[model samples]
Target: MDEPVLEVRDLVKHYPVRNGLLRRSTGAVKAVDGVSLTLDRGKTLGLVGESGSGKSTLARVLVGIEKPTSGQVLVDGEDVTRLSQAGRKQLRRDVQMVFQDPYTSLNPRMSVGEIVGEPFAIHGITPAGGRRAAVGELLELVGLDPDHANRYPHQFSGGQRQRVGIARALALRPKILVCDEPVSALDVSVQGQVINLLEDLQEELGLSYLFVAHDLGVVRHIAHDVAVMYLGRIVEQGREAEVYDGAQHPYTQALLSAVPVPDPSVRLVAPSLVEPVETGVSTSSTSGGVGGGAIVLEGDPPSPVDPPSGCPFHTRCWLAPALPEAQPDPIPSYPPTDRPDAGLRLVPAVCETDLPALVPRPEVGSAAAPGDVPAAGPGAASHVVACHFARGLAAPRVEV
Candidate 1:
C-alpha cells in the first residue's frame, strides 16, 4: 500500500485566556485536542462536527495558517510543525487551503487573474506560457471563463467567486487541499456544481483532500472515510460505509440520526436509547442538516477554556446511564458546598474520571451481521470509537 500523503499525530491547538489588568494567563481553549488521522493520496477524508468543535481550527493548522500548540503534522514523511522559514514556504507549495467564505477570502480590488496568479509571484515561479496564460488555464480548469479573468470578484456570483478561490489554491499545484466548508456559503444548486468540480479535479489531478463540513449528507456523498469530531477530539472514525452503517459511539449515532432523509412518508423517530433533554439551548441542526428527529443534547458544548475532565463528550452523552456502574463514586457537586445536590447532576464516575482512547471495534463495520462481531480485516481495524462502552452499545438504526 502507498504511504499516506498526509498524517496528523495527536495534533493539539490551544488559545490562552487572559484576565486582570496585568493580563495574567488564566486558562486555555482546548481546540483541536489530540487529533490523529491519515489522508491517503487521492482520497477525501470528511471531517464532520458541530459549530464550535474546532473543525476550522484543525484545517487552519494543516494549511499553516495557525501553529499547533503541540503534536505533529506530517506532510509526506516530513514533520511540518518544526519547519524553518524556507521550509515553511516550501510547505505552502505542498499544501493549500480553500477558505469557507467566498466574499471575504478574495480581495475585491484584484482582478480574478491577479488573485489566481498571486501564488506564482509569491513563489517566484514563471509558468511555461507566462503567468497570464497559466492563470487563464487555471481559471478554465475550475469552470470559470478565462475571459472573465480581468474582472473583479464583486462581478461574479458566490459560486463563481468560490471557483476563483479554488483556482487560486491550485495555482501552486499543491499536493493536499484543506477545504474548510468550501461549499457552506453557496446556494444549494451551486454547491453541487462545486462539489462535482472538486471530484473531477481529484480524479484528474490525483489530489488528496481534507474536506471539513457540518453537512453529513455532503460528506456521505463525497468522502471515502468519515471522522466524527466533538469538542476538538475525534470521537469516531471509519470508512464511509462502516461509519454510516455501524456507528458505535453515542455521539456518532446522534449525528447520523440527524441526517435528513428524502422520503416524506418515512416518519422519523428519535433513537430509543437517547432521551431528549430541554436545555435552553435550541435543538437545531447542530450537524447542519434539517428534517430528521435530532438527538438533542443537553446544554451547549462545554467551554474549551475549561473542558470537562475524563471523556470530553461525557457531559452531553445520553448513553452514560446505560454504561457499567460508576467506579469509586459519582463526581461531587461544584462549589464544594454542604449540599450534595448543589450543582450539575452526577455522571458515571468512570466517565468523569478516565478519558477513552480511540480503539478498533471489529464487531462494528459495514459487512458485519446484526449482533455479530465480524473478524477484523486490515481495513476493519481502522473502524475505531472513543467511547468506553462502544463494544456494548448496539449499532444505531439511523433511518427508522
Candidate 2:
C-alpha cells in the first residue's frame, strides 16, 4: 500500500491551567488527547465533532501553529514533532493551514497579492516570473480574477476572502492542508462553492486534506474517510462508507441523527438506554422505530481540565445502561461529599471504571466470533470504535 502523507500517533495537546500570584501550574485542559489517525495521500479525512472537542487544537498542532504535549506527527514517515528550527520551516512548507474565519485570518492591511506572496518572502524563494505573477496565478487558480491580487481582504466578500486564504495556503505548494472549518463562517449558498473549489484544488494539486468541521453534511460531501471525535478522543473511525453506513459508537449515531434531513416524511430517532431525565433542557427520545428527531444529548461536555475518570463520554452516553454489570469504581477526585446533587442514575459500572480501547471491529458480513478482530493499517477496511458494548450495538446508518 502507498504510504500515508500524514500520520498522527497518540497525539496530545494540553493547556496548563495556572493560578495564584506565583502562577503555579494546576491542571491541564486535555485538548486533543491521544488522537491517532492516518491521512493517506490525495485523500480527505473529515474530523467531525461538537464545539470544544479539540478539533481546531489538533489542526493547529498538525500545522505547526501550536506545539503538542506528546505523541508523534509523521510527515512521509519522518516525525516532525521535534524538528529543529530549519526543519520546522520546511515542515510549514509541507503542511499549511486554512483558518476557520476568513474575516480575521487575512491581514487587512496587506493586499491579496502581498498576502499570497508572503510565503515566498519568508522562504526566500523567487518564482519564475516574480512574486506578483505567481500570486496572480494562485488567485486565478482559486477562481478569483487575477487582477484582484491588488485588492485588500476587506474589499472581498466572505467567500472571496476565504479563496484568498486558500490561495495563500497553496502559495508554497504544500503537500497537506489542515482546513480548520474553512467554510463554516460563509453563507450557506457560498459554502458549496468553497467546498467545490477545495475539491478541484485537491485533485489538481494532489493535496491531502484534514478537513475539520462540526457540520456532518459538509464532511459527508467531501470526506473519503471519517473520524468521529468526542471530548478529545476519537470514538469511531472508518472509511466514509463504513462510518456513514455502519456506525457503531453511540456518539457517532447521535451525531448522524442530528444531520438535517430535507424530506418531511423521514424522521430521525435516537433511542436512549434509560428514561429521559427532566433537566429543563429539551431532550429527544426514540420515536417508535429508528428512522427522524435529533438526539438531544443531556448536559454539556465535562470540563477538559477535570475530565471524567474512565471514558470521558460515559456521562452522556446513551448506550452505557444496556451493557452488562461490573464492579463500581468511583472517581477519586469527586468523592461522595463533592459529587453533584443531580441524584443517581443507572449505568454500567464498567462504563465509569474502564476506558475502552479503540479496537477494530469484525469485518462486514462476518459474525463477530470471540477473538475475531480485523487488523487496522493502511488500506484496511477496519471499522474501529472505542465502546465496550459496540460489539452488541449495531447502530442503524442514517443517510444525511
lDDT values of the candidates? 0.79, 0.79
TM-score attained by model 1: 0.84
* lDDT by residue (tens digit), candidate 1, 40-113: 99999999999999999999999888999999999999999999989999999999999999989999899999
The residue-level lDDT of candidate 2 at 126 comes to 99
Q: Write the per-residue lDDT of candidate 2 for residues 1-400, one digit (tens) a residue.
A: 6459999999999999999999999989999889999899999999999999999999999999899999999999999998999999999999999999998999999998899999999999999998889988999999999987888999999999999999999999999999999999999999999999999999999999999998988998999999999889998998888887776766776776677778633434333323333431233443411442566677898999888877777777754543334545322221133223212222256566655457776543344531344446555556788765454334445443
Root-mean-square deviation per candidate: 8.0, 7.2
TM-score (C-alpha) between model 2 and the true structure: 0.87
The candidate maximizing TM-score is: 2
Candidate 2 ranges with C-alpha deviation above 4 Å: 264-289, 322-347, 364-381, 396-400
